[model samples]
Structure formats: structure tokens, C-alpha cells
Target chain A: MTTSIRLPKELKVRVSEAAGHAGISSHHFILQAIEEKTLKEELNTNFYEEAEKRYTQIIETGECVSWEEMRCYLESLQSVPNPIKPIARKLEFNVKN
Target chain B: MTTSIRLPKELKVRVSEAAGHAGISSHHFILQAIEEKTLKEELNTNFYEEAEKRYTQIIETGECVSWEEMRCYLESLQSVPNPIKPIARKLEFNVKN
Candidate 1:
């Protein structure tokens, strides 16, 4: 499929240069970039939807577990001798402000 | 930071319904979904760029190898005698049309 995309002359120049550096045609480079981006977005959307569905099931059924407990359990599953087991962690809280 | 997003009434209704089913506020649900999509897109873009860069390097350095050879190498690495090793394969040719 062929499509027309309008871009600023500078941006077009940059893309052409990059495509040349990559030893590929400008069209192929753009197509590949777009394909990568679209695929990523789609995968992420599906993952989030699945996660939300599971979370909803747990919440409505009163089967929810605290993030702290979940983290501790995961940590315990790792080798005890590994010091890297308890690395920097960022926790997400579901509490409403 | 918060930004207002305009959506059609029907789309809004769908989002609201989904939020209610997920047992979360529409705002939170939308935020989570957007986050998931953005993350996925970013990761995919990076992956594709890296692959393209490597491919370009191979092309420019005259170190190109057939996709068949690479697939065979990967298949050999798998625990063989397993029929699953040689599953359906899609070959990508760099030849320009």
C-alpha cells in the first residue's frame, strides 16, 4: 500500500539522510519506523486491557492483595543469596486522592 | 499535569461504561490505558530503530548474510529433535522492488 505523507522540508531532509546512512530507501525506512511504532502501541493497549480486566475481577470478587505483600512474595521467590533481589523498586498505589 | 481531551459523546459513553465495569473512575482508566499505549509504542520504536541500525550496518559493511542462514542458526540453538523447531517462517528480503 502506498500513502502520501507531508512533512516539513527539514524533517524530510533528515529522514532522507538517515535512510541513506542506513543503506535503505527513504520509503522503507519510514514504513519500518511506522510499523514498529504501531505494533508497540497495539501490544501495549492489549496488555493494559488484559491487566485491567484481571484487576477488575480481583477487586469485585474481594480477592485483591496489597502491592507490598505482592512484592514481598515475589522477592521471596528469588534466590536468597542474590543481593540484587531487592533492587530499587517503584510502587504504584491505587489509592484515590 | 492535566490536559483536557475532547471526545465524541458516544466514545465518552463507551469509556464510562468500560470504567464502571472495571470498577475504576473513567479518569483513572483512561490514564492507565494511555500510559500502557505510550509505553508500548516507545519500546517498539526503540526496538525497531535498533534492528534497523544493525541491518544498515550489515548492509554498508558488506557483511550481509541470508535470512535462511540466520534462521537455521537459531533453530540449531533450540533443543532439537523437537518438531516445533522448524515451524512456519516468514522471510524478509532486503531487495527493493
Candidate 2:
């Protein structure tokens, strides 16, 4: 799939390397990646139709929110009519640490 | 669900705008978006555990291959031992055009 191209250049190189090491083409490698991503997203999501409707939007926007913040907001919705919603921001992973 | 925070800045503003329009917080808007995305991905993918294993890799790499390209590659795999796999490439969207 054109999946590999959607990936960062370094990742494309890694996928190719993985494919080459396994004696397969980069095409197969990307297919597996897309399938894997799809499955993972399904497991985390609660709504199917909603996802389908928003797929194009999500892709075009390339926007994402973390599960933790969404969960907290949802939990608050049940109790507070005017709940304090978390602001949308970037992941503070600080991966290097 | 620190999900909304994972979204891009523009998306964050849009979510907040939508939330304000609907008399809700941006948090709820983002939560819905994440759920929708998750469901959409699941429908497209065939495997589950493989997806879980690759989520991190996918996010970090940010690569994407189109479904059409991937499907062709897979079909070739069935017929050719050394299928001339499609090379991973960027989408020729040319959205403006």
C-alpha cells in the first residue's frame, strides 16, 4: 500500500530493511502495517459508524487526541453539566527521558 | 484520555469551536473524534494482535500506503513467486487540482 509513503522517511527505510531481511517486498511490509494499524484503532474505539463517517476528516486533518484525557472528560460528563474539559494539546511523552 | 492533546493545534481550535457551538467542552468533541477514528481503523484492518504490536511503530513512523496499492501488491503475491511489488510512494492527491 501507499502506507509506507505516509510513514516518515526513516520508517520507510526501516520497513524496506525489514522486508528485505525477511525476503519480501516493501509492498507486503506496508500492507501488514496498515492492517495492523486498522486493528489497533478498532480495539480502542467504541463507535463504528462514527469512525467510518470521520475517516476522511481524520486523514485530512491528521489530528489525534489521547485516550486518557478523553476518558476523564467522559467521566466528568456523567456528573457535571458544566464539566471542566481538558484543552487539546500535544503528547508530552518526552520519549528521550 | 489525553487524546485531544494529541491532536494538531488547528484541530484543537476546531474541536473547541464545535464544542462551544454545541454548548459542550472541547474535551467531549475530541473524545468522539478518537472513538470514531478507532472504529474506522478496525473495519479496514483484518488482524487484531498484529495491530496492537505495531501501533507504536505506526505512530512513530507516520507512514501511510493507500489501500489500492496494498491490495494490488497482495494479489500479486498470490500469483507471482517474486511478484513485482508496488513500490511504496506518496499519494498523488493533487487536492488543489
Give the CA lDDT, 0 to 100, for residue B49 in model 2.
47
lDDT of 2 by residue, B1-97 (tens): 0101233355445445555654655444433443343444444343654786666555666555668888988998988898766654444554784
Query: What TM-score do all the candidates reach, one by one?
Result: 0.37, 0.22
Candidate 1 deviation (Cα RMSD): 18.7
What is the C-alpha DockQ of each candidate? 0.02, 0.02
Off by over 4 Å in 2: A1-97, B1-8, B47-97
Residue B6, model 1: Cα distance from true site in angstroms? 3.4
Write down the lDDT of every candidate, Cα atoms only.
Answer: 0.58, 0.53
Give a tens-digit lDDT track for model 1, residues B1-97: 3333444465456556666666777666555554443445456667999999977876666565566766886777775563333433334566888
lDDT tens readout by residue for model 2, A1-97? 0101223455445555656654666555444443443444445443664787667555666555668878988999999898877764445554685
Native A-B interface contacts kept, per candidate: 0.00, 0.00
Docking class of 2: incorrect
RMSD of each: 18.7, 24.6
